[model samples]
Target: MRISPSDEFLADLERLLLDQGVAPDQARAAAVAVGVEWGGQSVYIRLRGPYLARAVAAAYDGANVGELATRFRISRAQVYKLLNKANEADRPQLEQARLPGT
Candidate 1:
């Protein structure tokens, strides 16, 4: 399956580190190590929140909300909130796509 860009980057970094003489396990660990915590949330979330929200919303439409909440370790309410935010964010783009006279 196609992986996310972050995952791909980590893999590449690990390989590069190994080539540079880092031990195998250490290279892998270093590749996955990211110091992203900020203000009670991860920098990953801060940067990718909207994208994640939209992905969550799409999954909510096709999958079990409870399972999604459990997997994300977030409350059901938060799941809904993300979905709503995603929908709101999508509205303007959707509106702009409509025929001008229609």
Candidate 2:
């Protein structure tokens, strides 16, 4: 079965990386690590006020997905993925509104 990333999951992972001073690409891998599911692994993220959430949300508001990707330093594929996950079902929550350190 193919794996899909949950918006909440990715947001939390991003916050964790931000807290640890990790790079986005590094955080990408870590995000994927948790985003993947196949049993055995058991971890999840519940972000609040995450950077990507607000950033992506703002970008997704009035710009094309491609443009948003460039602005965020990610690929089109990643942008599309974020867009889909970020729709109503993936809107940032109050609990998921914080970064790692702040």
* Highest-lDDT candidate: 1
| Local accuracy of candidate 1 as per-residue lDDT tens digits, 1-102 | 988666666788788889879999999778766412222233333633676687688778555789878867778888888888988988999999999899
lDDT of 1: 0.74
> How many clashing pairs does model 2 include?
7
Q: Candidate 1: which pairs clash?
A: none
Per-candidate Cα RMSD to the true structure, in Å, reads 10.9, 12.9
TM-score of 2: 0.33
Per-model TM-score, in order, reads 0.51, 0.33
Model 2 — which ten-residue stretch has the worst lDDT? 40-49
* C-alpha RMSD of candidate 1: 10.9
